[model samples]
Target chain A: MSVTDELLANNAEYAASFTGPLPLPPAKHVAVLACMDARLNVYGVLGLEEGDAHVIRNAGGVVTEDEIRSLAISQRLLGTTEIILIHHTDCGMLTFTDDEFRTSIRRDTGVKPAWSSEAFPDVEDDVRQSLARIRTSPFIPHRDSVRGFVFDVATGKLNEVR
Target chain B: MSVTDELLANNAEYAASFTGPLPLPPAKHVAVLACMDARLNVYGVLGLEEGDAHVIRNAGGVVTEDEIRSLAISQRLLGTTEIILIHHTDCGMLTFTDDEFRTSIRRDTGVKPAWSSEAFPDVEDDVRQSLARIRTSPFIPHRDSVRGFVFDVATGKLNEVR
Candidate 1:
């Protein structure tokens, strides 16, 4: 079976005991933007249960335009106010650059993507950058309620960037 | 204390028993793109452990340029092959349109967002559209391994979106 099939099977088991119909707005009125790294459990680490917060993740947790778009919707449409930007140590983003990755993909697949990978050298710096992006965005409603952190993959500790 | 501060406190408790240095490459060779809704536990539903799979999330799990950028990296740099596009029921994205939201945000914050909210009325159709985007993107490798599903928030069940 494909991995999707396996996950579907797993979901069947989970759904057997499922308790849901949670409210549309998160209970805590918070939104988390974090790296897509499999090691970081954004909810478990943050002590958030189901229906507590919205978790938006991508390659380095960088606050790109798309992230801002989501945040705007979260704040304006769904009532989420606070924003947390979480990057992590040992991120795959730290291992490569946009130009280098673009070159590699072009070489392998003969396609040069117009979008940047948004890689960074330091996780903390990247977190700070993301924080600034949210704080400065005119579309985000709760700019003053933003925070940033770098999660250590080895220890699972989150170091505040500010 | 702020919600973020509470999360930081929880992180401290979690870090006390932290496991170390999971490999950068996902062990399952898979990636899941899902909605940022708080009710859906992407990892738990998929039975994914730490370092098992890359999970990319956004407002609606819609495939955008940035999502493609992240997926390209997941496939090209980190050895992930399969992709799963999962959208869920009761999504806030079902509530509004690009023009309506843009107008609302403009009236509230006096700034019109240049990006689309990527909202849709039907979650299953949105999942199919995301799957098609991934399949058609030249930047994404292993497009044939892509699948789509609509996760039922109340039931915790995933209905395949053929």
Candidate 2:
């Protein structure tokens, strides 16, 4: 079976004991934007249960127009007020640069992507960049509690970036 | 204390027992794009552990340019092959129209967003839409195993969107 099939089988087991249909709005009124790193389980890291917070993630956990869009909807429509941003050590985005990645894609696909690859040399700097993007975006109304962090891979500890 | 602080305390407990520093690439060779809904716990639902799959999420779980960017990096740089698109039942995206959302934002912020809100009336249709977005993208290398599903909030089951 494909790994997808294996996960589907796992889902059957998950559904058997599940009782949900939680309230529409997050009980904690928070949203988290984190990297799409396979190792960083946002729910576990935050001790989140169902109906707790809106979890938004991407390649570098970097803020793009899309992330701002997600955060605007999350805060405006869903009532989440606080925001948390997470980037982690040993991320794939750190391995390459925007120019090299785009050029490689261009050579392979014959159509170069116009978008920025959003790769970063430093994780904390990017986390601060994400925080700044959210703060500067006029779309997101709640900015008081916006914070950023870098998750240590080996220790699994989140260190806040001031 | 803020909810962010409470979550930070939780992170401490998570760190206490955490044993990680897993390999950077996903072990299961799949990427899951799902809604950022608070109730849909992608890890628990899929029985995924750390390092299993790349979980990418947004407000609607809809594919846009950023998703295309992320998928290109995932396939080209990280080696994930299969794609899973998940849109859950009773998602916040269905509660408002794009025009309504943009108009409300314009009223509040004095500026309108150029991006689409990506709201849809039907969950399965949006799942299909997300699937199509990935299938048609020339940037994403693998499309053969791309699948979409609507996760049932009440039953905790993922119903395939065929």
Candidate 3:
């Protein structure tokens, strides 16, 4: 069976005892932007329960225009006042360069993407970059409340990125 | 204390007995793109453990250029094959329109965004759009294995979307 089917079965069990209908705005007025890595449990690692925070994730957790767009809406409309950017060690993003990945994809598929992969060699540096992006964005109203961190997949630890 | 400080303290407790060093590639060969709603535990509801699957999340879990970029790398380099697009009920995306939200942000920060918020009227239809985006992306190598679902945040249930 596909993993989707397995997950569907699992969701059935989860739904059987589900108790929710959490508030629309997060209780803490916080939002976390973190890597989509399977090992990093943003909520569990951070001790956040349902309705506590909004978690925005993508590969590498790097801030992008789209991410800013989301954050704008998150803060302007949803009452979120804080942002946390988290990137992790051993990230696939750390494994490649923009040029090399572009070339690789170009060879695999006949089309070349116009956007950069936003890859970086250092996870902490990437985190700092993301933090800066959020801090400087005109759309984000809670710039001073933003911070960044690096999650160690092996140790399950998060180290602050300045 | 900020939520980041609280999360750091929690991470210390979590890291004390942490054990990992899982292989770089996910064991399940699947990637799930879901909303970053604090209530939807992507891993728990899907019965996924660390190192099993890659979970990519954003505001609405909408398929954007960056998401496709990430999927390209997920499939081309990391060996992830199947893709699951999941959107949830009562999403913040459902609370406003692109134009209305743009107006709000513009009013709040005097800066007009150049991109769309990707807001939608129907969560199920948004799931279908994301699925189609993945299925048609030239960068994604495992398009044939793509599927879509709408998760019920209130009930912890996921309904397939065509």
Candidate 4:
């Protein structure tokens, strides 16, 4: 089995034992955008339970189209009013230049990666650029509150970067 | 101090201890959309380090607008190509129905949640609903791979649900 497969199976085994669902806190329904890095234990660090906050994760801890659509629905339908964006330290997404990544893809697959960049060539601008994208998105409810942060994987903590 | 303040301080201290960036793996940059359940550990289950995958989180692992904007930049600038949507068992966002959530907001904040079924509904369909959103999102590159899973908070296992 692949590493992902092994991981998934192990997770299922563990989950089967939870007998009952964990207790959830009465927090203001919150929507958080965070990175998917395995090192970040968001629940433990945030002192949250299963039902406290809604979390959305993607590459580079950056948001994507589906995320926006969901967030729209979350605010419109779900009880989430707060938006917390969490990026993390030692992030893999920040490690490579676009050219380097493309080259790796070519070397591995014998074909170049098939994505485009309206603002590539400028590798250093990713953080600010991603932040801008979220802040200005039209799909976000105009009346909702939104905030961003950077989480450090090694430390298990959060930093308010936005 | 507030829990958030404490975590923020911990994050800063942890970040200061890093000598330099950690090594990044050559794996295809994977983006994960996961729920914000405190019991779930993305790092422990996935065996990921400080820098591995990109994680975007929201309530019920549902996608939203802000998430989409971030994802667009991730695809456009960050090196992400695959998406992993993780919804865990015993999610809190599921506890309250749309009316309950909206009622809670009204009682606490004195404002009604916006967006109606005409354009947006209060209750999200489910993990299946979330998966469909990812599959049809326009921002995701047509060639990039997107997969969805359900993470069991009790077991730390992720299963492909879509």
Candidate 5:
């Protein structure tokens, strides 16, 4: 079986014991923007149960137009008032640069990407940058509790980026 | 304490038993795109362990330029070969049209959002739409095992979007 099939089998088991159809809005009234890193399981890290908070993720957990769009909808429609941002150590994004990645993709695919790869030299700086993006945005209504953290991959601890 | 502080407390417990850093690349060689719904815990739904797969999420699990950027980075930089697309039942995306959402944001903020809100009328159709996005994109290298599904929120079951 393909790995997809294996995961599907796992899903069958998950669904069997699943108790869901929770209310539409997040119970905790928070939204989390985190890296798409396989290791940073947002649910586990935050001790969140199902239906707790909106979790938005991307390549570097960097804020972009798309992320702003997600956050706007999250708070405006869903009523999430707090935001948590998580970036981690040993990130693949730290391994490359935007110019290098865009150049490589152009050479391989003949189409240069217009978007910034959002590769950052420093994780904490990027976290602060992401926080700024949310705080200054007019679309997002709530910015009172926006916080950023750099999670230690080795220890799984979140150190606030203050 | 605020909810963020509460989650920080949870993180202390998580880190107490936390193990050392895993490798940068996903061990499962898979990438999952799903909605930013709180109820659809991607890890629990797919029985995914940390470091198993890359999880990208947004408002609708819809494919956009940023998602294309993420998938490219995942397939090219990392070694993930398979892609899974997940949209769920009773999705907030189905509640409004893109035009309506855009208009509301424009009226509220006095500036129109250039990005599409990506609201869809149907869930399964949107799943197929997201799947076709990956299949047709030239940037993503490995598209052999791309699949799409709709998690039935009421049943906690994932129904494959055929």
Candidate 6:
């Protein structure tokens, strides 16, 4: 089957696991900004249900312009009041330098000027930096409560990094 | 020091790493729905950068009404053309039965009239099941491409399970 067909199959079984209709709280909602790593299981860690939280993720769980836009929507429009930022140890962002990543992309895509030194660079600093940017961003409701944590990919533990 | 102070210190250092401005690409954007588990790193696996993708996540990385809402917005406004569902091995989604989770939340939150059974549930099937849901979701854009993968938390590797 094609990739699309496969995705449908997986989602079907996943959906079937939910025997009942789990919904989110309408009044007090939470938003999570986390890395795209597979190791940090936010639901299991937080003891959450299917619709309990709003999670936004990216590499290193960093805050970007789009992330800010989404955060603003979640807080101002969607009723999300608390924000959790989760970074992790042994991140791939720590593995390579920006120059290295650009080189790899150039070789793979065969595109001249593939990405600048700043494009894919700066993974290691994304976590703490992203938290600050999100916390202070005027776009996000200033009153929202924001916290940051570091999830250990190897240990499956979360520590309050902020 | 206060959490705010820490956030500022780390973020300032983090922001200094961005030495150059990067350009945005016009390629079709992809949305990755995955688990919040700390074991998997989506960036290194996908080789992504800032402004490249949208990641919506939950406990098992399972799709729910809210996740769908986010997906709806992501596709309707954010120019996303694809969805990638990633589930992983040794997930907590498979650890506790639904009864256990409901009981725990009830005891802790003191909010009875237990919510839907779909809250935090088990992940029984493999990658194929997750893939099927994404492909068949009526709400997902028909033109969008969707795929599924299972990441091994222990090995830090991913196999296209679907």
Per-candidate DockQ vs. reference: 0.82, 0.91, 0.72, 0.24, 0.88, 0.05
> lDDT of candidate 1?
0.87
lDDT (Cα) of model 4: 0.55
Strongest candidate by DockQ: 2
lDDT by residue (B18-87, candidate 1, tens digit) is 8887988999999999999999789888888888999999999999999998898899889998998889
Deviation in Å, model 5, residue B120 alpha carbon: 0.3
Q: What's candidate 2's i-RMS value? A: 0.6
Q: Order the candidate numbers by lDDT, best to worst.
A: 2, 5, 1, 3, 4, 6
lDDT of 3 by residue, B25-142 (tens): 8888988988877677787778787888888888899999989977887888889989988898889899889999888778877877889989999988888889888888888888
Model 6 misplacement above 4 A? A1-162, B1-8, B19-28, B113-129
Q: Order the numbered candidates by DockQ, best leading.
A: 2, 5, 1, 3, 4, 6
Task: Score candidate 5 by TM-score against the native.
Answer: 0.99
Cα deviation of B65, candidate 4, in Å:
2.6
Report residue B9 deviation for candidate 1 (angstroms).
Answer: 1.6
Give DockQ: model 6. Answer: 0.05
B1-162: candidate 4 lDDT, tens digit per residue: 343444455456555654434334324466566665545556555654444655566556666554554465455445666666676665555554566655655675566556321121322346667667666665556334666676654445566763
Please give, for residues B53-121, the per-residue lDDT of candidate 6 as tens digits.
666665566655455545644554345777777877766456555566446545654543233323233
Question: What tens-digit string does per-residue lDDT give for candidate 1 at A7-55?
Answer: 7788888889889878889999999999999898887789888899999
RMSD from true fold, candidate 2: 0.6
Clashes of each: 0, 0, 0, 47, 0, 38
Error of 3 at B158 (Å): 0.7
| Prediction RMSDs, each to the true structure | 1.1, 0.6, 1.3, 7.4, 0.8, 14.4
Evaluate chain B of model 6: give its TM-score. 0.79
How do the residues A56-145 of candidate 2 rate in per-residue lDDT, one tens digit apiece?
Answer: 999999999999999999989889999999999988988999999999988998989989999999988999899999899999999999
Q: Would you estimate the TM-scores of all the predictions?
A: 0.97, 0.99, 0.97, 0.57, 0.99, 0.49
